[model samples]
Target: MPNDSPYKAALQKLFRTRLVARLDDLRQALKRQSRTTILHALRAVGYLTSYSHAGRYYTLERIPQFDPKGLWRYRQIGFSSRGTLRATLIHLVETSPAGQTHTELQDLLHLRVHDTLRLLVRARELQRKPFQDTYVYLSAKPKPASRQWAERQKLAPPPAPKERNLARVIDILVDLLHHPEDDARAVCQRLRAGGHPVTRAQIETIWAHYHLKKTPHVRSRHGRL
Candidate 1:
């Protein structure tokens, strides 16, 4: 945790995400709604905190902002159903190198295709290697951690220069998407000015993958079964 961490700040910044909204709504709804209603809302929002006999409660450690809307990026990628989806994806990919495909991973991890895909895409932690029609999810080359001043300065193991460079570029692209109001053309141009080789095609791909438009499909009464 940094000294300037603004987590304890006002609700405005905190509730900007979907997950926070869900959690807030649930807390409020529970006060007015029935137990059943609260339970259903909790299920939808992935809140399953269990309490034991002695009033002891147990659940995974979570930050205050761990709500469904904050999970929009992952959901957009296809990681279906909330509930530790972020941690699970990181653990799986970290242990299993060469990356796991959509179907193979879904079965292995007991996740639906949509959910799995969404997490993989949002985290930007997986490297997508194209093999014919589909893509393979490889572990993103992690950046080497810098040694502390207390320790002897040693050359830390670094990921391949190319991988590290690509990761930095992609990371910036993801950040840009978060602020869609930022002009894409101007952002790309500024990045290029800073000596980054971010081409229009690469920018387009990032936009397409992250900016998922979820338009509802309406079926006629007769067509609806």
Candidate 2:
């Protein structure tokens, strides 16, 4: 961008302090009226757009530091310091302390990556194992895959609270069957409205009992979860 252009000056000033922005953020920051306006401005500034996750955020031509994951995220937005989607995905998988899974990668990336994951596995860059109804992405190399599984076992939520009160629990389970995506809090709210004394903790315990789902915690750019 030309040094004297108002857009360039504004972006440089803003980016000096805050490093990245999503489309909405840029539109608000630039006091623009439309997505097209922001897109045009971004093109002018030669900005780098996120290629993984939501791909909603943009950065100036460069950012100095990145995690071993090769990405930085603030809230729902992410900036991939690495060059492209495939490259960034490879970096994330190859350097991970343990191999990752489609769900785990999707959570970290905040977008769907199963197709890419399958492609990687087919290319011999990754491997996988059947887990529950899904698969855990494994390292093509054995050692890391073994370590990842060991850690995964170690990290598995301890044997879920033993199920008691079969009748009430079954009712709750049937209720959850209708909306398979409800979280514990949501389930609790609906159940309470229906006059059940279901606590979020109780619902969580139930999910544990069934081993329903596992949410993996990802490391930040600095490598802390």
Candidate 3:
């Protein structure tokens, strides 16, 4: 089609009004029954097919205001400067300082990417490794993957202290003995009121250790539940 073609003008007008158009919409606006002609017109004007919605949507390349991640969304339909969803995921993982996790990707893309991530790993286009309880997606290259892993380690929260004070445990146990109906919070309040300085976490730990339940039943002097 020529630059002065009426079909291209009509397509541009449609895009100006709707911002995004489906292939059918483009065909209708161009007044052409041929998919090839409509697509040719779109290409001539520089168009982007959405990475989302199974590429059902299209917009002019100049229309999107891409974010720092090279992503743009129009009414939940996503467009990526990197092109398809697979390419976008690879780019994001390769560039991330600490890599990206399933949750992180899902949160950012607002789409479930479990299958895509699995496929990328299987194809060796991306790498995945265990991080905390979830897997982190990394660059396929070893050096970058190692750097991302190390950066991820630095970002991890410090481990919780494993050992509880014996005195604090005893204080919590004694308080539970007096008020069997009290839950961990109630026990902590009572112990703190009496200057025991026990935290609810410590009280809960003792309760868990003793297999104790806070119910209406009272404990006998022998300490049997």
Best by lDDT: 3
Clashes of each: 16, 0, 0
lDDT for position 19 in model 2: 77
Q: TM-score for all predictions?
A: 0.27, 0.45, 0.71
- What digit string (tens of lDDT, one per residue) describes model 3 on residues 1-225? 555378768977897788898888887887788878878887778888888898899999889999999999989999999888999999999999999999998888889899999999999999998988999999999999999999998877644335567777677767777887767777777777888887777666667666677776567998857
What are the per-residue Cα lDDT tens digits for candidate 2 across 1-225? Answer: 233277777777778888777677777678776777667777787777777544556787666366666666666566677756666677777666656777778877777888888788899888887765678776778888788777666655545444576766876788778767667777788988988777787777877777776344466999956
Task: Using lDDT as the measure, name the better of candidate 1 and candidate 3.
Answer: 3
State the lDDT of candidate 1 residue by residue for 3-69, as single tens digits: 2223222222333443323334544533434545444433443332321111122122243333333
Candidate RMSDs in Å, in order, are: 22.7, 16.0, 10.0
Cα RMSD of predicted structure 2 = 16.0
Highest TM-score: which candidate? 3
Per-candidate local distance difference test: 0.44, 0.72, 0.84
